[model samples]
Target: MCRGWCWGCGWCCWAWWGRSPPSCRRCSTTGRWIICRPVPIRRGWRRSRSSCPGARRPSWCLCITGTVGSVPPIGRPPPLRSPRSGSGIGWSPSRGGVPAEDGATLMYPVASNGPGTDEKLRDAFVERVREVARSRGGLTVEVGGPGALAADAGKVYESLGGPLLYTTVGVVAVLLILIYRSPVLWLVPLVVAGVADFLSMGVAYGLNQAFGTSVSGQSSAMMTILVFGAGTDYALLLVSRYREELRRVERPYEAMKVALRGCGPAVLASSGTVAAGLLCLLAADLNSSRGMGPLGMVGVLCALLAMLTLLPATLVLLGRRVFWPLVPAYGSEPKARRSLFSAMGSSAGRRPLTVLAGGAVLLGALALGTLDLPGSLKQEDSFVDRPESVAAMRTLAEAFPGQGTQPISVITPAGRTEATIAGIQGHEGVAAVERGRTGDGWTELSVIAKGAPQSAAETATIESLRDRLPESYIGGPSAEQLDLKDTNARDRLVVVPIVLLSVLLILVALLRSLVAPLLLVVAVVAVWAASLGIGGLVFGPVFGFEGTDPGLGLLSFVFLVALGVDYGIFLMHRMREESLAGAEPAAAALTALRTTGGVIASAGLVLAATFAVLLNMGLVQLVELGFVIAVGVLLDTFLVRTYLVTSASVALGRKVWWPGRLSREPAGPVEQPPGETPPSRERVAVG
Candidate 1:
């Protein structure tokens, strides 16, 4: 049962089903409108008297332009019995009214009734409308309003699931083929990542069903990307190490064990850092953000499990021939060449101060573009390609410039209905008031403001109404948006600090150096700012986006900081290992950069490419998020990790290990291979 407010003739009507007489009567002011119509599957379809048996008929009445009118009950239709003849208000409705020449909108002055029946009703309504339009050639139909918009958004998400999955798989497959250059070897990790994705979906579903965690379309899609992106990264590190070990260890199983032993700590720390950073989102108040925290963490964990356990088992079973074309022969030395990473490291080591300053200045300059970012995105501008619902909203806004099209609902305790009405009657922004459904100890009043929907005046009016009627619940589409904006803002303040602290802690623990962790954290923060600044500059001018998504900043910050620190872990951990093996500080820094640089570069490309898939998504928010993170990952990979971090390590020398025993100790005895003597400290140090 539902009640609705019609803006066309300023009428309040009730829709319901039962047997009742066709007659006109005066309705008591104390009475309420209840049991409204569900959007019909077919137009002009009405229930007959015999359809409902042995049930009491609920009474019905109408308020048209402030005049009392009696309307025929369910199963009967008569021109609205003219309102008690003496009332001056007319029932005339024209083309300029709410019902256009061929179309009309159904306005429900209530919040959504969850996702069950309300969702189906909206879907049925749209299907029926489109069916009619198709049958009657030249007739156009569009479903708009809050209910239809939600239904459309849900539909868009449903459609996106297939394409998003396919595109992500396709992108990862191509990259893996290029990276592995082995027909059989690439298949192993790809299949492993796919299994991890499937596992994440199952686990995420169980979590949602068991714990009542919110699962939105956005979060679900992001989980898939993380599974593949982060999973593949772990796989690459393991595989690269495994291949290196294969050349040294004679047996396949022994080689696999050796590979895992070498890279296992780095993989575990990297995934843990990502999980901890994402989990910080639990501090967020927004349902999507908070929910995404656990869901994303689940994805990373699943990937980590697959890469460590399943991937190693599969590779050991396949043996060395898995890399048939370029199989690593036992005891054969790997090609010794001057790789690009080696050249880059040498440059940074030679001029540490110059490289560090230049990188910092570039990031700071890029961050200045944040000033150009547009305002929070409007609901009408959420989609990358405007749908019919958005078009209809635009038309309504233009047609109804001065009057609010959507009502502001004030649900008060039934006992306090009169007091609420009295307070609302003369409110500053209100233009008209219509009493709506009453039941379950609550009474709903639909107030139409003088200001158009979502305007400054309307927002002020909603805020004022909430202040005036403290006991009543003031809400509607606009109010919901207001709350969303406020909640997102609040979440940023609470979640940002938690994310930073958590990631910093993970880095400090893994690297065992206070200064190194601080440097990594500061560098990633700089990358986030620069990425967002680039988004601000491009989103408006190049992409033609209306405005930025409200949650973009918070989500991007969490991702960039967490994922960016991943490369830092790879480089710093390797550098630490070199230092412990008795290498000089500058040599350790340069060697670490050269050794891990290729893997980090490859992993960064995979992560960035996976997120770039979001650019193809329909929502402006997804596109913006994908763009920022993708750009940040690239910046972190090619610029920050390569130059700034390496240069800082070179310049700081032993102090990069700060207060750790390595900072105070001289180079320990070198572990040289048989018959190969260690180089002198003078030969290894930069300049």
Candidate 2:
């Protein structure tokens, strides 16, 4: 039974199932109103009869919007039968004295009991509204959910920023302070790095804005690291030479010019190789990978410019103030004490083939890990904690019967038979399904799965579903996600080769020797293998980190191969200079190591320390990347540079620069050659 009240109408009514009697007349009386309250019927329902003189049948039409004073007795409250007379019993519904029945509309019947009937009615109401909306103008709805790409990018940036910047800048600052012990010297590299960073970021921003390309946050973090490490390394090389020249030469400006003339090409060549290596990223289809290519290239270029232009200008202005508090004696000669690196270089030069073979075997064994590396795009692997959203997702999974809130969408043509949807429900691993219509006569099905969304098993199931889906129905999200995975995999294969080729080309251009560039490639590849293998062994076995993040592998490959070449360049350039001075192979190697060894080692320390800071990041990807790069630089500087290159130069002898026609004969005794002073016994001659 249902009841309602009409305020100000002062009317109520009830209906009898089978009879009209005298009490019904009360509803029709002039200048009066009637109230007949509802009463529940029992079983097959029977009603009691009452006779009256002015009889009128109870209205078959029951008005639901009226007050029911009581229900009729029959296992229910008795229905109230109010009088039509004036006074307290009956009042005119209208203030002007009209009867309530005179202004009433037709009544409708309402059912009040059933199981699951409410849900059916709600569905019907919603469908009706949707139909009405469709009849007007078609509405469009988003297929999946909101895109979180930007937020994910932001997280990458935040994760990498703190450690890379602070550690690298701090380490370089301390190293510079130690070397010169002067405020100006300590600040020079920092200032130069700042300028390089500004130029790189500005150019990248302009390029992205103009081309409508997006740079990954990871690339930005890498750029920051590159700018500091590369900028400082170049600055140190130039400044060291500048300082040495200042002590020996009378004119500070001429010393600066001499320093530029000697170190400029070497710095440019090193930066060129690094930049070329970064350009390999362009071959990747993944936006993150591609973005890194240009971003890294820009950083190297900026560092190059700062070293060549801004650094020299600043040095010229500072003059001998660069080493003020610790000024050298009137004419300081190069230090004679042998360093550990020089000694190592001497030993390796004496046993070139043995050193090369031993280093090659060790690096080759480490490279084996690369073959066993796994690639997956699980979100857990990307972030530090599973993230709050991912945690909430797990909670939702527990609450539901299936794999939380991850949804796989199935799309089909509208007007599909119900049998088709039933078939989809019967598919393996499908937990539940919801159906809705899309415009243009299409239907969308949201299928819930029983396991983690996007897992290998789930992906397999999705693939099976794609293959098994009825010709009339189609797979949407499941199929598309798989396609994205395949595309990324293909992109990796294509990109890695392209990057390798680009690096080779750059090496040839910088070294101007086909043999040297080829050998350089071999050394870099060895470093890459060794670094990654060590990372795998350490991160997986010792630290309990899971499989390597794919992004880490790609970024690490570029960084290790490209940045690692810096040490090789330093060692080779010095060796070439010493060799051209006509020293014997062993003596030349020792001289090269003794001259450039300290600066290269210092550069390696600064770069490695900077990368090591990434260990503090929460994400395993950063940890892997940080340690891999740090280890690669250390290996390159200490082992490859001091041992391998020195050994090769000795063994190859005059063949090291073969086909270039550089003479092996020593430049005869030091001649004043006009204005220059001949070196005294206190000063060792260097060409």
| lDDT agreement with native, every candidate | 0.72, 0.58
| lDDT tens digits, residue span 1-687, model 1 | 011112111111110011011100111111010111222211111122112122111111111111112111112111122223321211111112243222333221222221223333445444443343334233233445565566566666766767888899899888888888878888888887877776676566557557766656787778888999999999889998888777778877777777777789988998899999999998887777888899899989989987887778777777889987879899787766666888999999999999999999999999998999988787778888887767766766654567677777667777888888888888979987766656556776778788977788999999899889877777666777777778788889999999999998888888888999999999999999999999999999999998898899999999999899988998899888788878889988888888888889889999999999999998898899999999999999999999999999999998988878889885586675432223222111010
State the local distance difference test value for candidate 2.
0.58
What TM-scores do the predictions have?
0.81, 0.70
Number of the top TM-score candidate: 1
Please estimate how well model 1 matches the true structure, expressed as its whole-model Cα lDDT: 0.72
Candidate 1 lDDT at 572 equals 93
Q: Candidate 1: where are CA atoms >4 Å away?
A: 1-118, 129-140, 667-687
Score candidate 2 by TM-score against the native: 0.70
Every model: Cα RMSD to truth: 14.5, 25.8
- In terms of lDDT, the best-performing candidate is 1
Residue 554, model 1: Cα distance from true site in angstroms = 1.3
